[model samples]
Target: MAKLNINVRSFSYKKGIPTDPTGNGGGFVFDCRGILNPGRKEEFKTQTGRDEAVIKYLETETKIALFLEGVFQVIDISIEDYIQRGFENLEINFGCTGGQHRSVYSADTTAKYIENKFPEVQVTVQHVVQEEKNWINEAY
Candidate 1:
């Protein structure tokens, strides 16, 4: 069986999309900008999507669950096919205003979802804005 490498990412639309490190040019890009932003709220301004408060705001106050349902359905189809086809690389990107809240939330959740659904798949997550800050792996 071919090992499927799924590179999940969060990026800022303003800063542009994250490039595929695997050099496979085509993959999924889901825009998170359409959802209500928590950043506009003073409480969530400094918090990343990984933060409990930001996660709560996004999960309870916005349409993030619905949006992710659609995204997961789409990606699920492709992942099943990719595994069978022995394809090796897949990239999924979520973009929003700052790449701090919405995009990050989606990417992290999607990575976890993919991990649970496709046990053999190798999932890596990157927060581009956070990476630029040199704090990629930390729970910020």
Candidate 2:
């Protein structure tokens, strides 16, 4: 089974390719800046995407759902090919102006979706600026 490393980063903190321990230059980077930003609202200014309010706002008021649908379509293909090819590592990154909100939510959602869909694959999600990481299948 292949393992997927989904990284979420802040554009303000880092640019260019993410550090790949696999050393194979394998990954995809998606920019979330084009999506509606929840940070622009005063009520959500202090909130991260992990918060229920922010998640609800993003899900209801923005195009994030559609955007992620497209993201999953592309990533699903890549994941399948990687598993078939016996490749062990695949990385996908989501970046926004700050790693706190949109990027974090997207990364977490993507990781969970991958874990549910492909239980045979290992999945790890990391939020760069937040310093948070989750190993989805580790407890299973």
Q: Candidate 1: deviation at residue 23, Å?
A: 1.9
What would you estimate as the lDDT of candidate 2? Answer: 0.74
Pairs that clash in candidate 2: none
All candidates: TM-score: 0.94, 0.84
| Model 2, runs deviating above 4 Å | 1-17, 132-140
Per-residue lDDT over 42-95 for candidate 1, one digit per residue giving the tens place of the 0 to 100 score: 887777898999899999999999999999999999999999999999999999
**For each candidate, what is the lDDT?**
0.91, 0.74
Root-mean-square deviation per candidate: 3.0, 6.5
Quick one: best lDDT, which candidate? 1
- Model 1 misplaced stretches (Cα beyond 4 Å): 135-140
* Backbone N/Cα/C clashes per model: 0, 0
Best by TM-score: 1
